[model samples]
Target chain A: MKNKTILLASRPNGVPTQENFAFEVQDVPALQEGHVLLKSLYVSVDPYMRGRMSDAASYVAPYTVGEPITGGIVAEVIDSRNPQFPKGTVVMDRLPWQQYIVHDGSGLSKISPDIAPLSYHLGILGMPGLTAYFGLLHIGDPKPGETVVVSGAAGAVGTVVGQIAKLKGCRVVGVAGSDDKIAYLKEALGFDEAINYKTVGDLKEAMAQACPDGVDVYFDNVGGEISDAVYLKLNKFARIAICGQIAYYNATSAPTGMRVEPILLKKSALMKGFIVSDFAQNFNTAAKDLVTWLKEGKLQYQETISEGFENIPQAFLGLFSGENTGKQLVKVADREG
Target chain B: MKNKTILLASRPNGVPTQENFAFEVQDVPALQEGHVLLKSLYVSVDPYMRGRMSDAASYVAPYTVGEPITGGIVAEVIDSRNPQFPKGTVVMDRLPWQQYIVHDGSGLSKISPDIAPLSYHLGILGMPGLTAYFGLLHIGDPKPGETVVVSGAAGAVGTVVGQIAKLKGCRVVGVAGSDDKIAYLKEALGFDEAINYKTVGDLKEAMAQACPDGVDVYFDNVGGEISDAVYLKLNKFARIAICGQIAYYNATSAPTGMRVEPILLKKSALMKGFIVSDFAQNFNTAAKDLVTWLKEGKLQYQETISEGFENIPQAFLGLFSGENTGKQLVKVADREG
Candidate 1:
């Protein structure tokens, strides 16, 4: 069988381009014992993947040049030598951006299509969901009646974060790039307030107006000027969970902004950074809560799905430009029995 | 009897000078039934006091212009109408910078002259000590074989912080402004390594050389370029205790520097700012450990005593220039029976 794979052509200088990724066709190898032959159904393209494209030391290893770029993918098991993952079983795992993958069934997590859609495992029911769950609940620790300000509030993790904060009885305020996202966060997600950062006259003033009680919990996904403004209005003992810095992900040079120590000192605040995997030990507990919330219709999610395997690079690049509303994904192939 | 008191004449524009303080003389009022006549002996001059000199919102209420500047002062009860405190009893409390004070004795903490020196109540056994204890043990939580770096390492809090981290079996590196302070930290305080931040050609390079294992815990007493350099050397899961930011205390305008969120995110680190009072519920536990360490000779302290009540303003100004080695105290008056 013929398989197509996307490889990291070169490390990006600033914002990544089409030249940074290359596509190659190869013959799919036969599945070996204890291995599974997987056909990609849905591939996730997230802001965090930008960190992997660089050679910098990070939580996850950087993507090697001329190698298949790997990420969270929902795939159908077409052929399996392992009984644990039999044929026709849909699973999710960190897999390469390939049409077909030959993999040992080590890290593959079985996904139940009955609970939600197959692609939902790549988004709200998967990494983005887990990231928001742990980062917001565990780190942000929003208390009832307190105000929560989440940047990039229309994106995957940010959407879930704002929703969870609202569920926790917090006054949820969101900061996003577009009016559409701002409206979606406020109208659909039930956020107390939403500010279009791009359109706001003065972000700091807008944030103050949004959070009248001052920001008690800040779920930071976009770190830069938005975060700087948030720091100014932090209430005493505020909790800040630094989940992602999408604003600085594409910067070629070191990004500089307002020093936060003095502000944090004045507010006696806490700022912590983490990836979702840091809370892996408690994933089952979080997953249970997340599943229950989704089932009860208390949680909502959106995805910007780009069609075809060839559009994966463009889909990923579009993340930096705020092209997608929620979880950005690439639909590579259809599931087959 | 006559009483002399220092008042905040005007708010400091940047670095405070003698012009900001005014001395006033008045008649000492007769003590009330619940009051004690406190004679100020040793008055503490802390960098944190600079915050109150401004009208800005802070953990402590800003000192009102034309009102007495109050701080940690070890006083002798010359006359007392309260049964709780008798004549000649030494007490420590946040009191006005006055030669004589008619206080209600509500917040007075009785001090023992035998435990250490009377001045020690303003340094090793007082606020700075407690600040170091809670901010280090509770926030930093340095483990054995870990690398702990403390900025302002020769200051009262930093000296104690470095010693405590050493007691916890961690490799301790100190950052100070002067060669004398650096030598004092290494030779007198038993710091593993010391960096003179002012003299160092490249602080980042020096920190890299000093903390080869990377910084696991950072007890930051001075925030500025020194802190920026320390942030670069933070190891994964590093914890930073933001105790003080003396570097920007005298700045006329808002200070800005390198953003720390991305660095913290990349390393999965934690940075928290706090005043010692934030952990007041656990102060007794910290005091017990601190007292035990001091008696065991495991902890040592130094204080620069500026004589005369008239020089208190100059003594406070000296702190910004890093003139004091450990604790900075002004000897107001001799204790009287």
Candidate 2:
């Protein structure tokens, strides 16, 4: 039996293209001792993966040419060589962009199908959930009766940050790329206000109108005018968690410019940055809390699924274009529903 | 008796000048009810005063035209109308740049003559001392053996920051304008290393050599390229207390373009801006600890006394020229000493 796979053919200078990735089918190798055959059900396509595709220095190394692109996945153990696991056990793990894989279950987490839709392991209940959870709670430290503003509010992580801010008794405002996304941010996520960056005539005025008391906590996912606008409205002792800067990711020229120093001085605020991977050791505790929140319906999450393993790279590329309104993921195979 | 006085005549566009002040000779006013006639001894000249001169809006209100420029002072009550303060009592308080002041003791903090020299109140045991205290301990929380860097290290606040960092068991590096100031900072403050920014040929390489184990805590006083160079050497989770930006005080045009997003993304660090005034509420506790340290000889301080109340405006202007090494103060009058 053979499985379809996607490999990094080349590293793109700027925005990635289809030419940079090559699709191929290869026969599945026999499982060794303590190795389990994983049939990938869902493959995650995240923004951080872009940094891993280039050879430039980052927290993690880039994907080598002619190698499979690896990331988060929800897979099912069809054939097992390990004594601990039998056949047909479902799990969430980090693996390559392929339909099947043989790997150890050490880092793989068991996912109960009765609790959640298996695909959520690729998004809200996954790393993005923890990103918003720890970033806002630990770094942003939003207080009750305070105003909290989040950039990239329609994205997986940003969406969770705003909702969590609301749960913490904060007035939540969201910034998104499109009108529909903005509406969903407010109506679906319970954000107090939503800003459509595309149609907003003046960001500063819009932000001022939305956050009258000034922002007490700013969870920054999109770093550009959105971050700068929220920065101007920070109250005294405000805290900002810098999650990501998607705006300058694909730029071939120098990065964008903004005068942000006066904001800190004016408000006596703090700006801290971190990645979810930094808290990898505490993922178990965060997962338990996240699962409870999801089951209780206190937390809302959305997944934009693209069907078929052949369309995995296309789904990945769509992230930069703002094509996915929620967690962008690809479904490779069904898990016996 | 007639005495010299310098008052804030007007606010400046950027760097304040003599034209922005009014110098005059007036008879010392008579004491009123519950007020003491103080013979001004030492008046502090601080960088934050320049910020107070601007009306563009900040954490504190701008100084009004034709009013006494208010800051830290050490004075002697030659004539007293209040029973609480007897005649010939020495006090540390907020007074104007005048030979004498007759006013209620609203913000006055009395200083015993047995304590260190009265001028120390304007520098080490006063606002600057409290500023360096909280800015380092609370914001720039350094662990023992960590590398800490302080800019403007020979200045009033910067000197204390370096010394306090040393007491905290960190490898301290100070960045000053001249070799003399650097030597004073290293030798007197027990700074592990001192870098004269003006003579450094390559800032990045120099920082790398001085701080082989990247900077863990940065007490920033001068912001600009020096700040940019320091940002390059910050370790993961570094903490920066943006105390002052003496470098940008004279910026007549827009700041030079540069991006520091790498510090945020790569290091996962925090940068916080603070005013000495913001930490005013905590001054009592900070000063208590500071006074004890000073008494025990664990903490040290220096002053650059520019002579005469007539030089008050020029003394303030000299801050931009780096004329004063440590705490810049002006003697309004010598009470028959």
Candidate 3:
């Protein structure tokens, strides 16, 4: 058997191109003691990956050039050398983008395939799901009847954030790049109001019209002009959860925007930036709540799955252009591969 | 008896000038059943007053044109009709800038002069002191051995914030404009390091050198380039307490600076803007702690008191020019009146 791995070819200047990634084909090594030979099923492509590609100091270490890029991946244990991991067991772990990998199973969690679709683990039941869960609930703390305005509201985490805010009885307003996403968020996802930022000539005015009561909680995913507009409408004691800055990820130069401290001071507001791992201790509780919501059909999720392992780079790049409406994942192989 | 009252003559275009204030002389009215005739002892002039000079929406109501500008004041009750407030009682209240006024002792808190100087109620034991206490202890939450950087370090709130952070066993670095203020912070207040921002060629490098450990708690009072420099040195899970933005309080145009969301997100940090009143429920506890510290000689405060009531406007204008150190106030009259 052979394994195919994708390596970080070079650091990106701004937006990553295909040249930044390199593919390698090699023979799959035999599993060592207490190890399992896994076959990749689904690989997640997220906006946060862009941050890791840079050498700047961040929560996660930068991806080293000429090293395999690692992220959340769902895999099947095709061959196991330890009793802990039997063959045919499906698991999810942060793994490198590869056709097959041999792992010691140190961090792999056995995921039952019966609860939801197998791909759902990489989307609604995985990192993106938890990102939305904690960032919105723990940080944003949306109160019922309060207005929640989420930027990049059609993306993976944003979709879940809007849903969760709605579940908390908040008036949800979504800001996305496309009209299709706006319609989907309003009609399918039940968003109280949706603004297509690309078409909205005056985003501040659009946001004002949507959130008449003023924004109380802001779940920021795409930070830039959209967030600047949202900052203007923050009510007294507003809470802002800074989840992602996808809009400025590709900027070659340092990004500058309106000064926020004055606005925050005037409104006596709070803005916090956090990652899902920060709330790792409460993952079980969040997962249980998410699963309960999923089982009860009170929560819905969408995935933009691209086929073929070779198309992973394209799927990741698509995120910058707002090509995906929900969780963007690439299907590398079938479960029985 | 006659009263000299200062009114907001006109809204300032940029930095307020003495021309914006109007003085009117009138007879002091007799106290009503629930009112007290108070003689102003000391009137505080803080940077936050600039926010009220304009009609912009803020945490507090804007100072109405042609109306008295109200702020923290130490007064003596000369004649009291209310049993709650007797003659010779010294009290602290948010009162209008005036020499004498008849007020309904609604918000007055009797402050004993036996504990400290009567003006201490307007400085270390009052609004600025409570501001530093809550903004640092509650929001900043500086842990032992953590690095705390306070901007506008020699001012009323910044001075107290630094002392408190030191009491919490953290390394405190102060950023101020004048070398005199810097010397006072290091020598008098015992700050670990102090930076004279006006003379410092490279503020960011100076901060990096002063705070060898990256800043963990930022008590931001001056919110322009000084804060922009501090934002770059934030460590993981850093907490920024936005107390005041005196630097940009008089900006002719809307201020814009480097975007902070990406930096906050990368560092998994928190930045909150608040006034002292946000933590009103815990004021008594904070006051008790402050008083204890003062009694124990663990805390010391400096006052920049301009003599005579006529110098009130000059004292306030001097704040922008960095003329005063510690709490800036004007002496209106003696305690006995």
lDDT of 1 by residue, A48-92 (tens): 999999998888899999999999999999999999999999989
TM-scores of the candidates, chain A only:
0.98, 0.96, 0.98
lDDT tens string, model 3, B1-337?
Answer: 8889899999999999999998989998867798899999999999999989999887888999999989989999999898998999999889999999798888889998788888998989999999999999999999999999999899999999999999999999999998899899999999999999999999989989998889999999988889888999999999999998887899977789889899999888999999888989999999999999999999989999999988899999999999989999999999784
Query: What are the lDDT figures for the candidates, one per model?
Result: 0.92, 0.85, 0.92
Per-residue alpha-carbon lDDT of candidate 3 for residues A164-214, written as tens digits (9 for 90 to 100) = 999999999999999999999999999999999999999999999999999
TM-score of each: 0.99, 0.96, 0.98
CAPRI category for model 2: medium
Q: Which candidate is the best by TM-score?
A: 1
RMSD of each: 1.1, 2.0, 1.3
DockQ result, candidate 1: 0.86
| Model 3 misplaced regions, further than 4 Å | B30-34
Candidate 2 clashing pairs, residues 3+ apart or interchain:
none
Looking at model 3, give its docking quality level.
Answer: high
- In model 1, the clashing pairs are none
Give the lDDT of residue A107 in candidate 3. 78
* Ranking 2 against 3 by TM-score, winner: 3
Residue A171 in candidate 1, Cα distance off native in Å? 0.6
**i-RMSD per candidate, Å:** 0.8, 2.1, 0.8
